[model samples]
Target: MTIPLVRVHGVDDVRLDNIDKPRTAPGDVLIEVLLCGICGSDLGYIGMGGLGMTHPMPLGHELVGSVAEVGERVSHLQIGDRVVVNPMAGGNSIGNGGTEGAFSPYLLVRNVAADERAVIKIPDGLSVDQAAMVEPLSVALHGCRQGNAKAGDKVVIFGAGPIGLCVALCLNYLGVERLVIVDQSSHRLAAAESIGAVPFKAGSNNLGEFLIQQHGQSELMGMPVPSSDIYIEATGAKPVFEQIMNTAKTGARVVVLGLHKQSVPLDLANVLLRELNIVGSMAYSDEFPAVIEMLTGGKIDLQPIISHRFPLSQFSEAIAQASEPDEAIKVLIDCQC
Candidate 1:
């Protein structure tokens, strides 16, 4: 019983391979993967060699699937139940080098009864594709939470990628009316605009002037600056962080969600002078259920951010499409296809 999966072998190398199917244990639950999203971190891993493992490591964490086999000891879940998995669960690390990832026909959820956050049943009426988006949306929601984003705060996001767009959706759902998204792609900007976020092209105009016009203006050291209350740095580009630090008004909170592979020089002096609150957001914590509730209640629509879809067999093509920020926003892989 062999199953096909995607893994990273070495630098600039990622491909599908066949491995022995996992056997279900008494405390484990098996899931037949329905959909998995290609994350930017997956691409970063490919470019930077691998997932820092001696052997080929499985890749992909943003996923949702149906329960295929429930172990005898697992009473909370039943076969055929649709669920979203928390990859960071202790003793059941999926898609992050602990166990087999979701980019396959089946995934074994170990220690089902031990951790409550391990597997969550997807509520009725949520589409399968949208359910697959829960993981990333949780990440976006965590970023917003780290920034302590609240209602009536003027927010500016420095990227229009999946996380950036999802952050906009989360902020909007939280009753934040004024939101602006900056990106280099018109297509992604259009997607952001479709989600009720004001879109500004990254390099086409002066972002500081535009931000002042949209969010209002304030003075830092007697110099005019954008008065946005919150600034989320979702773009991993070094210059984007510098730009945010340069223009963030006094008392503004900046949430760093992007993964910066190389070291980024920060202006500590400006940060101190302006009294900026710069915080970093890791994966997620206690955000899955909240995001799911928002989805269940129709608080936000993730459908607009879904830019492309491909079958598991076409995984390479999907990776290529996902790498192009100008062409795609969120690329999903249909594992059950």
Candidate 2:
């Protein structure tokens, strides 16, 4: 049977074309894609047009699939095995295993060794859509690891988007004493509160004064809020990034997990004055294997993140959902259709 694929042929358009099903190349594996989660980078590529990202490329990096065929040289993966693609597979950074980008109905594993390389198998009870989120979830995990959140440290996240929420979720698992999530969106802030974090709605005139007067205490968490020992900036907006820089407490570790516009102004005196240590987290390392384990082990519940799904034919519709404010988080495309 000829497998149909939805390919991005241009800057802002996609085409549904019938392409031949991939064959089992010497060292490659053919996968039947189950679900591909829409990521922030995907929209950046589309919305930025030519300047936003590279052209004539598949945009998705968060993906999951099942093995349809495996090459003779491929020893580990066989036909009918469920799997998920790791985006860092080809990078020098960690967690860069598996295929290039898995956005099509079928994808090809590249020139890496199969036995020691390629995607990880999904255990029973983990749905394909949940498996698809391993990429972003790994990002959150890396942020948590970088922040070094201990059992009783105060952690504050700047954004309540998928990445921020994921970081909050993982930090809770790490036994952090208090999780303070800062966001401007009422909806996103509410969602953060639902998952054990004391949600702070920023963008208010009296936000700083209110927090100061109350002494960072939250009735929801039933305790005096700890000073932010570590801060994770998940939203890269210029003003928001500035707010994060100015507001971080002295002698704290700040991890920049969000992607910003081009660049922004920074107060050098603050860093020098406070002895703040700042670091930039590019992408995932070899964290997908652990993410797969976390998913299968049920350490984190990803169900809340995946708020919408669409068939492959509605690629445009799926991408559009990402910008809608009322839509919860992480809309996915079911490639099986």
RMSD of each: 1.2, 4.7
What candidate 2 gets wrong by more than 4 Å, as runs, is: 50-55, 91-101, 112-117, 209-226
lDDT of 1 by residue, 245-337 (tens): 899999999999998767999778998999999999998989999999889897777778998999999999999999998899899999977
Worst 10 residues of 2 by lDDT: 90-99
lDDT of 1 at 199: 94
lDDT of each: 0.90, 0.70
- Taking all chains together, the TM-score of candidate 2 against the true structure is 0.86
Clashes of 2: 7
